[model samples]
Target: EGDGAHGGFPADGVHRTSRLTAPPPVPPRSRLPRPRRGPLAIVVAVLLVLGVGTGVWYINSGQFTKVPPLLSKTEAQARDRLDEAGLDVGKVKHAYSDTVERGKVISTDPGVGDRIRKNDSVSLTVSDGPDTVKLPDVSGYRLDKARELLEDEGLEPGMVTKAFSGEVAKGFVISSKPGSGTTVRAGSAVALVVSKGSPVDVPDVTGDDPEDAKAELAEAGLKVRIADERVNSEYDSGQVARQTPDPGGRAAEGDTVTLTLSKGPRMIEVPDVVGDSVDDAKRKLEDAGFNVDEDRGLLGLFGDTVEKQSVDGGDTAPEGSTIKITIR
Candidate 1:
């Protein structure tokens, strides 16, 4: 009885020890996951918030001012008044007005009571007085002088044309491009044509004998004419001597000139010594042409026959030139 086990136990005489224990069961784990953010997404969100703040600041800072609508105030007075009102004066625009005097303010930008930030500019239109000015007649004045007068009157000169002026002297201003009394811009240009003196055609002196070269030149357009002639004794006499400046030369119209003429070359007549010995004949002719010669053989001893001679019967040569004769 003492060894028997309780229901279904082994009846052997061995008793069982306590069973081995296992680790306590693990506690059930929570399934929660960690939150994550990318670098680009975080940067974009930061930039968006900064951009919104900057835009709000830009809108709040922008501001504009309006000028008073006052009329007929002097420019200085308008500016002073605006400054006194804690506003700044801006660009002054000028315009012609029959109703307002020059340098007076005609109107202002944005009327009075315009809310503006500090340093806001208020623009004003200024009067340039009346648009009309009595034009000075500068037709006869020199171009430069006329320009000065026009500029003084705040007018411009325009257009120049040149015309022959029988009354006006050379190099003087003839007239302006535009007739006087024309209204134009203050800096407009005036054209001027100056006198260049009288115009005349050049003279012609071609083919005229130098002896009459001067007279012919006078008949033409030339007032002054010069003729140079050198006689070639070897050339035919009385023909036009050699001319210098050959034919055509230029001279002012109506200019006078000096003339040269040919005096026939100084000449000596050839001596006649026919029927004489060749040597003696040669001596006479040579003296005229400047020498003497003799033939060979029996004719040489007798002084032979005079055969050929230069200048045959009646030809002329320069006074000092020599003529030769052939003796047989």
Candidate 2:
């Protein structure tokens, strides 16, 4: 009661009641959670925008693209390159080449370094190999026809030779150099062989010895065919009497020349040479195929006429048999 403001006691001298301690007031900044620090939303947004821009650039970058050079590239490689550039592969063809290797690309249709649209097809020309060809079967063909065939096969006619061939016709090819089915470079030379027909000229061999006749016939490209049946003729025994095909006739090469050899004069009848002049008797005896022996010891001293004969007339004797005629 004495201190009403400081204590709860009333002002009066009545009883005062004592109470527990009062709670203190909390500070304004103490209840908040701990502040967190991480990457900014703005930075994340910038990264997202950059990624989208790059993807767009990559997906749509083929409209104004130029064709890539593809010369000398393999077919597979060229196809891959075209695919990478968003282009298509076109028709493929093969051609022989001299400088380009086989199984390699020789060139392109639109060519390298040309401007083209994306997705457009590019034609490809592949190399087969060097320009080469296989020789054809021109043997036995006509000369002119063989030449034509050679030309058609991309070959050239080189040397031409003529020869005798029994199996091939005249003016026809007998054989060919490099033969048939042989591979060679284009425009290469091919030698030709031509036939010279079959017939040959038979030489004149009459009156020649058998050995000489054989040599002559051989020189003329002919063979000999001596006949077994000999003939009686003016030619001496073992001499050529006659020949078939005559002299200076034509015959095939390797043909046999038939020849008839002589066996001297044949047997004949003796003529009546008696009572004839000496010259007349000689002529008569010779004509009758007989050798005349004159006995002029007694008759020949008196006259120039034949007096007697050794063999009677109309008698057969050896053609070359000797006969005696007494002449005066």
Which candidate achieves the best lDDT against the true structure?
A: 2
Per residue, candidate 1 scores C-alpha lDDT tens digits across 168-224 of 655457665555676654445667676544544433433345545556655765444
In the order shown, the candidates' Cα RMSDs to the true structure are 19.7, 21.6
lDDT of 2 by residue, 250-300 (tens): 776767889999987676888887788888889988887778888889536
Residue 23, candidate 1: alpha-carbon lDDT:
94
Global fold similarity of model 2 (TM-score): 0.39
Which runs of model 1 end up more than 4 angstroms from their true locations?
Answer: 1-121, 126-135, 147-161, 198-328
Q: Report lDDT (Cα) of residue 144, candidate 2.
A: 96
Maximum-TM-score candidate: 2
